[model samples]
Target chain A: MRQMMVGVVALSALMAFPAMAAEGKRVSVKGELIDTWCYFSGVMGRPDAVVGSAHHTCAMWCAAGGIPIGLLGEDGEVYMVLKLPGDDASNGGETFLTMTNDTVEAEGMVYERDGLTYLVVSEVTSNDGIPNRTHEDFGVVPGNVIPDAVVDKVLEEG
Target chain B: MRRLVTLLACAATPVVAQAPLPFDIGGSFSLVDQRGDTRTEDSFGGPSLLFFGYAQCQSICTVALPRMAEAVDLLAERGVEVQPVLVTVDPVRDTPASLRDHAPDIHPRLVALTGSEDALAGARKAFRVESEVIGEDIEGPLYAHGSFVYLLDAEGEVLTLLPPVLGADRMAEIAMGYLEAKP
Candidate 1:
């Protein structure tokens, strides 16, 4: 009787929190396709991570180099873009290469782990042309241009 | 046996559907502003839209920053004041002077920030933004980082993440929705 009671209590506890119950779902989302690593890492501190038509070559290289793809939804949700089984390798990187910087509608199965979301992309369609802003003239500057005072302060703190 | 199989399948199915799990996205930081003054998370007494990008960025930042400026302007027109902030990912080159030069082109009221490498790294980690130096031997070495704009409440708690796909007008509308809903 005691064992049965414990089992019932455990079952009730599991029923209370439902989020841990399933893998994910099949859904469609409309958004801009992005390279995950560069979008996440380079945008914060690096210029090369910027996403747009100007950076299409770099993005394509990254995608082909095995970096995962991502879709940034209009609602601010980020989905990790993936290729389904039997999908051509060219469909993800090669296709995205041509479609870089454009908004797209994608259908996929969405999953989440460790606070990050992933989408196994089954289909994709372009929604609009690329936005008209590009930074073609922005050139890299030398890294040693900081004033002596700031350098001193940083070294002192270090 | 059939009943047991059904029970097992039901047990394995996840209950919650749309919402992803809670994430660790925002935290406190101390950095220098475009004016070379030190500022903290509490410097802005109201809601702020924060994003990470470098002044030398030739791609997304160019578009994102201008749209951010427009969003700020739109919010102001609606009688909602929202601070727009740009935190540089390239600490080695994006000095206060650089920020000052670049920020005004985006918006007169935009605040640009940079700090020591350690401080910038700490802030990035707090926000879960990824950044790294690439192509050092190339003509124009650049840092790559995340491109999401984060909306934070007065107390510096993250409210939402904005992707680059949202236009200035749409961004303003969403931001207004959040501000209006604030108690």
Candidate 2:
């Protein structure tokens, strides 16, 4: 009888926490992409580049290039490619609407692929749709967030 | 799994032409840390362990910042006051506010700096670092930039360099060794 009660209580607890039950825990991955070049490079191989600084530059870029778009998940997982409308592009292809400020609360399973940790994202959305904006929104664009100082230095040395 | 991933990444380095060395430390630039204070070559007192990165970066920044903090704690145990200076190669993006937001998560003492593209270029050149903007693709708009921790003396001279993949203990050893040794 006591054992049955414990199991019932556990089941009740699991049902109570919907968000926790649905949303998988997220882990942040902060590094530069060292390799996996040819694979991703081909995804947007077309020479077309949307040039301009508007609110929808990323939208235009993706549309003009037909490139898949998504943000790097906090869990270091690859989220599904989000398709934004062509009208999503602002003037001059600036701003970019695809996941720009999306929080991407995802629920999924963790997997190890090609030796690296990967989270197979199931669902994603912006947390506030405003707070997640990166430094790019402020007109301060990063050539590369992870400075290639060491590699550059190494190359320079040889 | 992490180790295997790291090894594979290392082995896959494309055969690119080697670059020249004995990089410079000064050319032109200005930056600000989490405290909103401007950091120039002059502001960095004592020996500085310089790391070029941004707050938005997830993997290297998250792992390295905490490890750096732990390393600092270790150095403190040995009676050393070493500063972990982070200079953002992505100046146009990183700002005093952003650094402030990210600093607490990394380490309170982890100083972040940023400047203009010209300034960033000069600083990277001084250190001979490289980074480029990649467009959107299946993976993402990743910055295939360099990753390494640079050790600089009181005079801003390069002491030692560690790649991003190195662990905290190794970094602590390098940092503690230099702090103990007077050069």
| Model 1 Cα lDDT, one tens digit per residue, B78-133 | 99999999998887778998788888887888889899999998788777666656
Worst 10 residues of 1 chain A by lDDT: A1-10
Give me the iRMSD of candidate 1, please: 16.6
- What TM value does the first chain of each candidate achieve? 0.59, 0.31
Tens-place lDDT digits, model 1, residues A48-157:
33455555555655544334466767665667654433433312334544555567887777855223465767777546755624434431112223456875897799
lDDT of 2 by residue, B30-83 (tens): 666667776765466776667666666543455456666777677767777777
In the order shown, the candidates' Cα RMSDs to the true structure are 16.9, 22.0
**A5-65, model 2: which lDDT tens digit per residue?**
2122222322433222222234333221111211123222211111112123333323222
Q: After superposition, how far is residue B120 of candidate 1 from its true place, in Å?
A: 0.2
Q: What is candidate 2's local distance difference test score?
A: 0.44
Q: Give residue A2's error in model 1 in angstroms.
A: 43
